[model samples]
Target: MTFQAGGSFDIDAWDADKPYDERDGTKLTRVSVRKTFHGDLVGTSTTELITVESSAGPVAYVGIEHVQGILHGREGTFVLQHSAGSEDGTPGTQWLRWLIVPTSGTGELAGIRGVGQITVTEDGAHTWTLEYSLD
Candidate 1:
């Protein structure tokens, strides 16, 4: 739960939520900032369309990302928080997924790199908050 930034982070009540299974579940969160180098970051990504193998996987979920608003030398990437789990209100009792990876390239970022974390809550949603710095 530590980011690669040069300082310590104390995120205060940054709330985020999504609808699932005909209900809205509330979640608790915390973040450790790794980088805060300034610049506007703009990019897109795609998830690997996963299918339920057993009685696992989410019933439903949505992606609400926070793209890093920083860059350096016209190069940067993002860490997509591909978090998923069973929409059944029970956590640690099921298989939850936390996939963290760097964003693909284009434009000012031809071959940039970044790293971040993805957190999954038992209430039926997840969060992805990452930072990007020059390589």
Candidate 2:
């Protein structure tokens, strides 16, 4: 079975630093983010991301996100793996995939698997939709 969860989140904290420039003209940067969610689910999440920037534009990034909170009254914790990219800086040109780590769910959310998408509006509001299931 599958269920849908929709919500908006606020970035409680964000810190990004440009670490070092690689020899291949790719600049690598590290970013840490924290968020608080509201709507069908209420919780907090922390993410560690490594962004790769190429000469053409923003290239790709991979990150691990740890989320703790309640989803539809079920409390638990889980991890999401992030792999996403943008070919160019064009509007609506970015894509992202967030996958729930196998067997990473805890509490009532144990055995959860899902995929989610996030959209940031032009005004900077962040919204998310998650299609998931729990066994």
Candidate 3:
């Protein structure tokens, strides 16, 4: 059966390295982030990201996040592959999506498969929604 989950998350830590590559007015950097999930999902996550920034500000990022916690009432862990980007560095022009890594679920989350998205509110709050199923 498929299930839906929604919640907000707090960014506990964000450590970004100085630009490792810069050319044509664009910069690339590596960032490590930690977050605590709340609401329907309860747990913490660590994410590693490669981000690209232009003179217009953040343009894109790709990341892998390992989340360990309880979803709804099941306790386990899973991985999310993130792909996000903005055409003009505007919230309204961005797309932030998550793909559950196949076979990456553990414990009660085993066999989970789904896709999700992240929304950043104007006030800078981060919220998320997931549509998934477990075998």
Query: Which model scores highest in lDDT?
Result: 3
Q: After superposition, how far is residue 120 of candidate 3 from its true place, in Å?
A: 0.4
**Candidate 1 local lDDT, 1-135, one digit each (tens):** 232422222233333333222313343222222322321333333332222222333443333333343343353444444454455534554443323344554455434455544444555343444454433
Please give the ranking of all candidate structures by TM-score, highest first, separated by commas: 3, 2, 1
Off by over 4 Å in 2: none
What is the per-residue lDDT of model 2 for residues 1-135, given as tens digits with 9 covering 90 to 100? 999999999999989896666767788989999999998879999999998888877778899999999998999999999988878743378777789898999999999999997777888798888899999
Error of 2 at 30 (Å): 1.6
Better of 1 and 3 by TM-score: 3
Which is the leading candidate under TM-score?
3
1-135: candidate 3 lDDT, tens digit per residue: 999999999999999999999999999999999999998899999999999999999999999999999998999999999999999999999999999999999999999999999999999999999999999
Name the lDDT of candidate 1: 0.37
* TM-score of candidate 3 against the unseen true structure: 0.99
TM-score pick, better of 1 and 2: 2
lDDT of each: 0.37, 0.88, 0.98
lDDT of 3 at 67: 98
